[model samples]
Target: MNEDFYIDPDIHQSYTLPASVYTQQQYFDVFKKELFLPSWQWLGGKEWSDSLYTQMPHSFLPGCVDEPLLIVRNQNQLSCLSNVCTHRAKILVESPSAKPFISCGYHGRCFSPDGRFRSMPEFEAAQDFPSSKDDLKNYPLSSWNDFYFTALQPKYDLNTILAPIHQHLSSFPYDSLRPEPNLSKTYHVRANWLAYCDNYLEGFHIPYVHPTLNKAITYEDYEVRVFDHCNVQIARCKPGQKPVPLQKGDPDFGQNIYAYYWFVYPNFMINFYHWGISVNWVLPKTTDETEIRFLTYKRNDIPDSDFADTALDLTEIEDEAVVESVQKGLMSLTYHRGRFSPTREQGVHAFHRFIYTEVFADSENIAP
Candidate 1:
């Protein structure tokens, strides 16, 4: 295999990994270990906070990933717990609803809202009846502007990842923004998660792949600003076109904007428009399959009729087609890593640097 397919940092250029990275199971395994587990990802919003506070447990991943977890709100405090019974390890809280306590359907093991071991059936005869291990395992969780975030491995501090966006978005009233459920949708793409992200990191292909979107935003005025583990690409609106009004004192208040595309590390993209915000979460299913979830939250109500039919879907379809085509081409023996256009693809280059640092940093440090 041509290992040089991986981008060489020494080259100081924007280049992608060899095609095998998209097609090989070995590469996928490495990514799962080195990338996903350690990363802080956007799971769900705060809509479930009330339910959790009511002792109604909701599961994050069901059958596919099958991580049994429960969220509960008690005494004005919210907590997440492993949804496994303390007694026989039976799963707890299969469905979501308000309940006073959690009881295993199998052996009658019960836990309090805080995941403390409350009761067990027929355990009086046991010698070590009440050990600390009987309590459900709790995970670290934090909330920002009505959004709940958690991590499994939690290699880096959550604040480090969120600090930049928090500082940038401080002026906006994010807490008041209600999620528009009708605008939310998920699309399955036949490409790697990174490939989908690479497509998003730059507007290099907008003129070619997205003619309609290209018309909306001036291509020459496009600019990318990079931050730690995140990048913001400003899409300048055409002359004479009115831009979305920013919150008072916002730096970009007067600038005309077709869109503000913000990509957070690993797998989240916050796309801001005059009308509202669209949060895109990209989840990798397999080596070659990815699921992209788009959650649209309206900041300002704009008539759906004002835009073209299937506007979001068309953009997604165009993106899907191109990324899938790239995935296929990556498998060819002749194709290897390619160069990055510094002017147009700084965002993509920044992303590649992040991936390399996350995956191979330790390896590089230990090597001779």
Candidate 2:
């Protein structure tokens, strides 16, 4: 409820959303249309290989907004299809598998790997026979390293959003890093997904909220660099921590350790840690609820030990505490909006600007 901030048009600046955006159900309803549906998001990684097609259907977003989808490696091409049967809309592919074609258990409607309608029980008299409408809905899918990405209404190119990070990390052996299932976990937080993202946009609270992690990385050397709808904060690791060599001829050479914190606009965080990489995806279940999925990949066969588990758990719990508190505070009747620190909050500002552009672009009354 700090009111010292103003939206500066000269520099193309704006403040973060007021508390109501996180607390009120009405606002959250609009947020889904204005923010979530339009932005490019991280679905899941490309861990499902060609040989693993006929396994079990994976839940894309389970429990909250359960949009069941099927992933199949058909004719050597990876395809994602809506799991609902084209005949009666019954859920198909209950589990993952390597199957030649997807058959609906309810009525025998069959679909090809590319989501095309192939056969049905009694459809000979239909006028639009084998029409595209009968096929499963297909979403755009792309991949980086072994990680797969998708978008609902992808307005911008994935390459444009991820190009800089890709160039910087080109030489790093990301593909070599294997998924360590034991290290991955998910947390259901009682807060807006954006609230969680705001907490991650800066290192300002690190010295207080994450004492151990703060000590491991120097806050003074922390620098936030903004890109197109994305930002990267480079945090130099404390001495004695293992160092990750920068790509040859890269500008960030000679650094003892590199902690690359990347925020893909809307709600995905890809953190390049000293050990390997960790992907944090914030999925909105409702106005005041979010599901955070943490997937970790490791290099050099690092064993899953107590120290590693404790460090990860502590970091997550600390983040949840802060974000959840912020969500509650945003619900207060007296709260409104707050100012941004010009030096430390560039990431937050960049994100707000991106949101305004995506949401208010068509409104004639709103200034461009």
State in Å the error of residue 90, model 1. Answer: 2.8
TM-score to true structure, per model: 0.89, 0.89
lDDT of 1 by residue, 145-247 (tens): 7777666677888777777666655665565466767878988998887789989998999989998787778999799988777898989888655465466
Lowest lDDT 10-mer window, candidate 1?
Answer: 57-66
Deviation in Å, model 2, residue 68 alpha carbon: 3.0
Largest TM-score belongs to which candidate? 2
lDDT of 2 at 215: 69
**Residue-pair clashes per candidate:** 3, 14
- Error of model 1, residue 277, in angstroms: 1.3
Give candidate 1 regions above 4 Å deviation. 1-14, 50-66, 239-242, 247-249, 300-309, 364-368
Question: Per-residue lDDT tens digits of candidate 2, residues 1-368?
Answer: 12322344323355565665577676556656666665666655535652456534655545434567777776556666788887778889876666788888998988877888889878789786888889989877777776777656677888888887886677676765777677789899998888888888998898889988886788887899888768988888777766555766665766765578899887889987657788888888887789998988776545444125467689889999999998888888888877678778888877766765565443531222
Model 2 quality (TM-score): 0.89
